[model samples]
Target: MDHYEQQALRELQQWQIRMNKKPSLFNGLTKGLQNKVNNVIPDKIHEIMTSAIKNIVRAALLGSEFTTKKEVPSGLSLAERERLVRERLRFYKKAAATEGAATGAGGLFLGLADFPLLLTLKMKFLFEVAAIYGFDIKDYRERLYILHLFQLAFSSDARRREVYQKVLNWEATILEFPSLQAIDWRRFQQEYRDYIDLVKLLQLVPVVGAFIGAYANYHLLDNLGDTAMNGYRLRFLQQITITPK
Candidate 1:
């Protein structure tokens, strides 16, 4: 391997170790508390929330709304592709922050609107990142990988490890599922909602809502960008190792 590839492999190995680490006591307690809160909610409410997230995400996966026009030029190195990925990430983070500020300034209704809008921005950013890494977003498996990557980013510590395992063995894991419908939508939605609920709730406050919204969205995108780069790095480095010399 060249110097850059060797460096990337080291980084990917570190990320893998972090992904596999067990949740701390505090993380476990927080997850327990969230579970307790979820248990008290009515089944119908859970169904509604899960359905909403499922439909929105499914639509994004199947629809053209997030499709990118830019194609990765053939023969670009992983490092070059990641440079473009970082640029797109910066652009999306700014857009998400702007959208968050605008909606947060509006009121309860507008603050509520931020969920789908921010989700759209995130999904679109993932599509662009996948393209930059030379993955064919048109394939169902690739899109499924995107969804898992999203889960890995937003899930709680314990759940994150579980999702990370799936990401690590995606080729074999994907074979076990017949279709996207097999996904645990309820768990997926709950984990995501729980992860951001605190900051998002703050975004409903009148005066400080805009600032909180902007800051929250920017950091959330920043986290996602980091997770995505490492996620793709796993694939990139693996491909390099397995390819014929």
Candidate 2:
């Protein structure tokens, strides 16, 4: 392995240690708070939001309409590909911060609009990163991998460990994934909801909204970018033990 690949492998090993950890006391408290908040939200609104997120994610998983660029040449080195991936991430982080600031300043209605808009930004970034890593986003399996990356970035501690295991051993689990309709989307949505609850709630407030939105988005995108880089690094650099047919 070359120097850069060796550096990446070391980073991936450290990330694996983080992903395998159990939830801490702080995590337990946060989850409890999320449950209390959920209790206060009317069932109808909760259902509507969950259904919307699920359908949007399902559509993304099945379609490549978001990506205009084709996959890179197969001959590109891992170092070269990761350099391009980092560049894309820098560009998208600016975009996300911009979008977040604009919507955040517009009061309640526009604050709510950030949900789908930011989701689109994040997904589009993931598609670009996948293509940079030479994965075809047009393939459903690749798209599913993208979703796992998303879950890994944003889920609660318990859910993060579960999703991390699937991604870590993806050569086996990827094929075992159930049909799209079978995914527990309610849980998916809730875990994602709980993860971002604190920062996102502050994003709805009046005077502080814009600042919170910009900082939150800038950093969230930054986090996702790092997680995605290491995710693909782990997948490509690790040795896979293929089962016999």
Candidate 3:
């Protein structure tokens, strides 16, 4: 090991410690817990989702501002941003019909930014878009429960089966409404189970879901993976998976 390599390692460690010390980094969680989970999963998903969504939102906001504050940022020229967002919206919408609002990151942002009512509406809209692509989200009550499960399970760096059980624990509470209250459990449960499949898809898909899970855990826990560890893991996987002709 050379002096330069050792020095770089020390610097990276110190930087991580410094980041841990910052309260906003973990968004108020204790340093110990942050060390445990890390914001690896959610953070990555947020990064990609935000990058995709922000531009779309920026386009809409800019469009609205054109009549007032017409000036635009240097890199994000209004015309260019608009074009890119439109393209993204189209692609995502094509991926699944219930995904229409999910098509444009900007549109999702706008929905979230508007208010609680709008937030719920936007969620419903996302489900609708998914349905358009042949995904079922017709069970509102159960769909809500599934969403809660997703939020809780991916909300931290926990084991998959462990988190899944935790989600199931909420079933009683979610089903408390009597049949007389007009909430139908049989139908809703079926649909909710289907939505669970969607959530799992986002968590387990090799590149997309795994990266999201890693990013979410990293950001949530305020810790970075050992780069050396990551490199070794990748090499190991490649060695095992690749075969000579």
Leading candidate by TM-score: 2
Error of 2 at 84 (Å): 0.7
Q: Give lDDT per model, in order.
A: 0.84, 0.80, 0.33
Give model 1's clash tally: 0
Point out the higher-scoring one by lDDT: 2 or 3.
Answer: 2
Local accuracy of candidate 2 as per-residue lDDT tens digits, 1-245: 78887787778888889988999999899888888877875565465456667767877886656764655778788899998998999999999899889988987667777777778888889988988887878777787889889999999888899999888778787677665555667788887777775676678789889888889999989989988998888766753331211
Question: Worst 10-residue stretch by lDDT in candidate 2?
Answer: 236-245
Task: Give the per-residue lDDT digits (tens) of candidate 1, residues 1-245.
Answer: 77877787777778778888889999878877776766765675455446667778888677776678976798999889988998999999999999899999997778878877888888989988988888988887888899999999998888999999888887898997678778777788888888886677679789899999999999999999989998888887778773211
**Candidates ranked by lDDT, best first?**
1, 2, 3
Off by over 4 Å in 2: 40-48, 239-245
* TM-scores of all candidate predictions against the true structure: 0.90, 0.91, 0.23
The sequence of per-residue lDDT tens digits that candidate 3 reaches over residues 103-179 is 22233332233222222332333333222222224444434433433333232323223333433344464465333
Better candidate number, 1 or 2, judged by TM-score? 2
RMSD of each: 3.0, 3.1, 19.9
Greater TM-score among 2 and 3 belongs to 2
User: How close to the true structure is residue 199 of candidate 3, measured as C-alpha lDDT?
Assistant: 37
lDDT of 2: 0.80
